[model samples]
Target chain A: MNQISDLITAFLEQCERTPKHIAFSQDDRQISYQQFEQRTKKVAGYLTGSNQCIAIAMDRGIDAAIAIYGILRSGNSYLPLDINNPANRLNFIIADAHPVYIIGIGPCPENINIDSQETQWLDLRDLLISDFSYRNVQIKTDAIAAILYTSGSTGTPKGVALSHKAITNFATWAGTTFNISQSDHIASLAPFHFDLSIFDLFTSLSCGAIVSFIPNRLTLSPSKLTQWLCDNKITTWYTVPSLLSFIALKGSLETRPLSDLKQILFAGEVFPTPQLIKLTTLLPNVNLYNLYGPTETNVCCYWPVITKQLQADKNIPIGIPACNAVLTIDKTTHELLVESDNNFSGYWQNGKLNTVTFKPQGYATGDKVSINAKHEYCYHGRLDRMLKCSGYRVEPAEIESIINQLEGIETSVVIGLKDITSGQRPAAAVVIKKGHTLTHIIKPLRQKLPAYMFPCKFTELSAIPLLSNGKVDYLSIEKKLTH
Target chain B: MKPKIREFIFQELIFVANPDQFSDDDDLLEAGLDSMGIMRLIMFIEDNFGVTLPDEEIDPDNVQTLNALEKWILRHKK
Candidate 1:
């Protein structure tokens, strides 16, 4: 096994050895290692900025992959902007990250709000500049590689800065643990902005495996996604459990036997045991695993599913530590604390490093947990107000903050409702003024928030429910909504 | 039947910039109707139409369009 301290060095070595090996493949397009290296180099050649932050705004494609790798090669960190996000949200990230270069033909400050005139837009169509004279920049192992944005409690998205050392360690650990090799065909199912893409884009490339990008359209019909996985002969698949659970329920696993699929890894949220059980039974030959981590720490722990001990009602145990994660449970709160080489360097916001208030030992994981007799981590909900609407971490305060700003909304409280498919969906319980109706605020509120964070249900209330100590009565509202 | 499916999809399932202009034949998946939305949509169909669409039959041909969803529901409806 080769020693991997950095991603670029590992990728360069892989390319040199197996230039003919296919690196990335999409619907009709594919790129070899040699071609990918050249393309990434060409992309790096286009940038003239000394400011080492570049924002990429494109859908999940082979080009997006090249753009990301190219940005990394240029000794710059890449921030992926989900094109589906609202302009306000995208603007907030752009303003926060202070990215000098924005790649891909996405949203621009076209007379709306040019927060920075120094911003340069490079269209995705013209990404491959003809100039070959590009000077290579040296990247330190601790240099930020990717900055991923997640919903913040303070009414906006916060960027989690991941170092090259962080990703390389995690991805290398993943590649080694999964026994991935040149022959394995991996699937990239998550969007570029999501943390799950870290494994798909980096680990597969590092292992000299062909990573195939699947589109969102195929997911509407799980059968189509299943067929694509089988037809493409994807050997390994990793994604959030919600989509996988849907596939197991609706994809007719009996008709389409996925012979080539060797293993499946689910992360970002707890897999309901019933669905996990179905996947194990349906794909009897394939191995199943549950990886546990936040975006701040990329995959700190994992469990290889033991189907014999599976129960429908019980939660799956998050396995023992991996990837050199130093874990210590908070005795008082039972909150899981993790420290590792894979832990993110820091949280970034608007050209400044935000303090995460890390303790001497580890970063507080917000989740309340119990160490079972088997010595595995059993998750109990969050210690904070954060909720996972499916795999996307949502802060009700963020949604409520937006809703309160709208007209006719006296005071809005956003709460997560129980959902079968998605773990939870954010619903708004609004206190409206006498003269106005809820309809006026709907359109504007939708524009301010992303689709995932948008409240699925809105119930109009006469007044805000309050506790004895003057706190918002969330428990009362939850009972009212469900009943 | 088409209106009911269309209403449910537009109201709760998918999000499009100009939903009113969105046609009945428009693809819901492309407009951001994900797997979660599909599951909720199936449940809605069973409750409203009193028809249980088999798990294996939840293919693109049945749920891709408003017209397709209506046909799929009506075929099983008494």
Candidate 2:
């Protein structure tokens, strides 16, 4: 099981050794390693075709898990699509990726401009029930494992293509670094589309540990999330910092002793100092880690937040790079450049953008970091207009593009305002046409954007203030919000 | 049980239309209440009504509409 060449091999080896052990679990339902192997094999059998990529639009459950493994087992890469996303965004991804098969429970999106002749819709439930089974399809190490789409600054969603090598490398590094073993019950909190899920999925599988997924419905309910951790006896937990904060403040974590919960790894955004302190106070014995990286580079740097280290400084460092990752700061702009084998291959189908995004060494993370006297990387802030909202990476320009499309909207600017509860939320300020009220464009805006992208608040202005360089005066806008 | 909850929702979720235009049966999610909005609404309810909502009570059947949320508040009230 330790001879990890690729994810499929690592998973299969685990299945061979611990066939009866539970690999994944949902509410009451558990899928053993043997059952997971067989289910994925059935999916792989159906996936035998000319299609190189399969789009999975299933709900966040065992079906989605099986479909992903099945795609990999069939020598095809998976493209995880959130069916909850607006029809426009889904359709756009389908058109761009040109996935040969879409496995999900929902009806086909209307006006889907994909080639109906080539594209086949495989019902996930039917596949789960089917008896069709096949052996693993050999996949090249360099071949893509998955393509996770992220918000692009240029209006269109860009897919970050991760290869089998890249994923396996990171998983190996994480599994060893964290000492994730069969005894650990890992909690899979993030969705499949998000990169955080990769660590949760692979690290658990690689170690032959049980990966318990927190239901999407329960994610918003902080009390339920903490309760789930306690009930499942999840030893190793990895998720966004906001979820931890929510549980600490809103949920009843302090009331009960979650003795089984040992490690809490948080990433995607800066954990608020006060909230982190509160969490540490509650879970005194728990090992806390701050994992940092964009989708393109998985988790490159990790900080083990020891209580002694925290008593001196309120700011948590991003810490040293992972075994396979190298981080260098640009002397000019202080932008963080991450070089790692875990770096994504490139953006899907956007060769022009890919050249700009990926360097020969690694990917250019738009985040800026400062090195302290401790030689640890401390997150300053994002250099670009992109924002991390409720653990999702968002490009403000993308929101602005959607806003500008509305009739009677002259110009719009979206900014992430710091919030005590949910890290940062997007707030939009706009200037509208003379006759139009705010109500006229809000509905259309909602139709186009997802909830996380929705502006927490909207402000009207006669004219959007601009700096001497003609860019929107963001400083003035922040000042206005604070006032 | 409370008009202020509805008022706060309308004010907070400015994307939604006037509160008077909608019936209690209207799906707040469909109307523009996202997951974050739901949390905000829960916080408002907890602070004003002095009620703590269980995780199981936050399902669509209990919180999707104004009527359901009102019923939830009444049931969970301290």
Best by DockQ: 1
**What is every candidate's alpha-carbon RMSD to the true fold?**
2.9, 3.1
Error of 1 at A187 (Å): 0.7
lDDT of 2 at A150: 91
DockQ of every model listed? 0.39, 0.32
Chain A superposition TM-score, candidate 1: 0.97
lDDT of 2 at A262: 86
True contacts kept of 1: 0.43
Per-residue accuracy of model 2 over A370-468 as CA lDDT, tens digit each: 988989998888888888887899999889988998998998988988865556888888899998988766667777787778886787888888999
Candidate 2 segments whose C-alpha is farther than 4 A from its true place: A1-3, A49-51, A106-116, A125-136, A311-313, A350-357, A479-483, B1-14, B17-78
B1-78, model 2: which lDDT tens digit per residue? 457877887766535634587778888877767555676778778887778887545655777888998988888775
Alpha-carbon DockQ of candidate 1: 0.39
Off by over 4 Å in 1: A49-51, A105-114, A125-127, A355-357, B1-33, B44-67, B76-78
In order, the first chain's TM-score in every candidate is 0.97, 0.94
lDDT of 1 by residue, A36-96 (tens): 9998988888776543778887888888988999898888889998878888878888888
Model 2, CA-based lDDT: 0.80
Best by TM-score: 1
